[model samples]
Target: MTGTPRLDDPHAFIRAHTALMAPPMVPEVELHLAVETVAIWEQTEEALGEMGLPPPFWAFAWAGGQALARYCLDNPAIVSGLRVLDFAAGGAVSGIAAMKAGAATVEACELDAFAIAAIETNAQANGVALTTRLGDLVGTDDGWDVVLAGDVFYEAEPARLIGGWLETLNARGATVLIGDPGRSFLPQDRLERLAEYTVPVTRDLEDREVRQAKVWKYR
Candidate 1:
């Protein structure tokens, strides 16, 4: 972690390693995205001399995020004038969308230092405002009127923790929305379908080039 390029200057690292690309489903927003998964992951791991780091999810516009961003853009009423939190906000996609849609406040929660930097960079690129907190925020509800998460159900442990938090928030009358694309851990039974979208994705990360993702309101 000492003097690692990603740690030393995340904004520069992102610019060097990735290109700015517009997600096909959410054309209005652009992000610094990885062109290929393996090469970028390998290079970063080799530079840091560590292998346990998770994939660079913050570099890509995931299917779930695309669906959520599109929904927020098309239906500004959901976030307009509301305090919104983009849970596990990778590159601040949905949060940026919420801000663009006239959200009163937008914040992102991410534990990874690299991801936190990426979100700020991406937010600036899109002329959106974003405040990032460094930690897991599943246990705290700060009266957010809208809580949106994208592609967070892929892993089991995180899925369990975040799912429970969302449920609690829903019970408290906060509008909770999840953007999921057939992830194995998504709690489908507990969600009410809101919208579905055909999101362009990389085959290296998913089974298909385009995934049909759904936005669900926690119920």
Candidate 2:
């Protein structure tokens, strides 16, 4: 009787696996987050019946995402009445903040189906609406006025590709913003710092109780 849960019902999985809670840096918004990192990661792989699938990043509010969401909420003019894209939007924290800050529209894109489900459920939990796109939107541009990416510079190849794309977007008149907590792959030289925050995080995930995360604008 204990086989894998149906992968098609991601919303059910999300609801069953996570708790609806607010991130410490941005308490105005709530997300479905896993309490214990290892348990959720193991459960996700078990349920998917796959060994090499990506970790359940959607189940935690990383420091970078918390910092970015805090920035958006504190400075509403950055997203007010503009079209915003939350790229690699794990649980759509920044996107939800944009909507709360008066963005005209918010589109959250993620490569993981579970992330998409988490985003949708999180949006609903906060009483906001967000358009969800499930796919790899790395090289595409949909004419967003502002693009927000949080916690995306952890890997080398993706960081290289997305850094180039974000630069291109900035050159083409899009306001591109990035949030990161001093990750190894961040293109620091190409960005200008805007704001910083001390975000609380679980030690199991970040190895520290607090992280110094920053918001940067592509230059």
Candidate 3:
């Protein structure tokens, strides 16, 4: 339990390291999430033997994602019959919510291999179908009708790149939605608020029990 986990079978690794549960804000759909944040981060770092690897963001249901998923569940009409892209989808929470809300199709895109496996597992657990895309999809347009991005504006550089790309997508008439808990780099001036939620979160991950999360549409 102290050493690196074998990642040859990412599915098995995810199943062994996480539990199936519902996020607090969106209980209608279940996800495979890590019970302990630090433990999973340490384990993944050890397994990869690299300190530069990103933290296990996919292992937890972030406040922003929870809020976004809740909005999708409450207002199904927004996504019904539209092709959606869950950009930088961590655990595919919003994507699963969209599918349950009657979306025509959902593609959950992530760069982490473990995230890809977790997305597939979470999709199946909720009995929702999601297409998993593994890579950096920035600066690319796939002609999706609706694009959902949750908790993606945490850092400066990535936020800059993704924000510009999202603006481009919005200009092209694709409905781009962003969910965020007021992260440091969120482009507030370029977004129009759609909805807000008081999302529950774990202190180990967010340093608080609740967060004021908002869903925004690019304007």
Per-model TM-score on C-alpha atoms: 0.93, 0.95, 0.95
Model 2: clashing residue pairs? none
For model 2, the local distance difference test gives 0.89
Model 3: lowest-lDDT 10 consecutive positions: 45-54
- Per-candidate total of colliding backbone pairs: 0, 0, 0
Tell me the TM-score of model 2: 0.95
- lDDT per residue for candidate 2 within 1-219, as digits (tens), equals 155346778898888888999999988999999987888888886765563446788999988888889999999999999999999999999999999999999999998878898999999999999999999888899999999999989999989999999999999999998999999999999889999998888988788889999999976
Task: Tell me how far the alpha carbon of residue 87 in candidate 1 is from the true structure, in angstroms, after superposition.
Answer: 0.5
Give per-residue CA lDDT, model 1, range 137-219, as digits (tens).
98998999999999989899989998998999999998998999999999999889999998888888786798999999976
How good is model 1 by TM-score? 0.93
Candidate 2 ranges with C-alpha deviation above 4 Å: 1-5, 49-53
Writing each residue's lDDT as its tens digit, candidate 3 over 86-145 gives 998999999999999999999999988888988999998988899999999999998999
Query: All candidates' lDDT scores?
Result: 0.87, 0.89, 0.89
Candidate 1 error regions (>4 Å): 1-6, 48-53
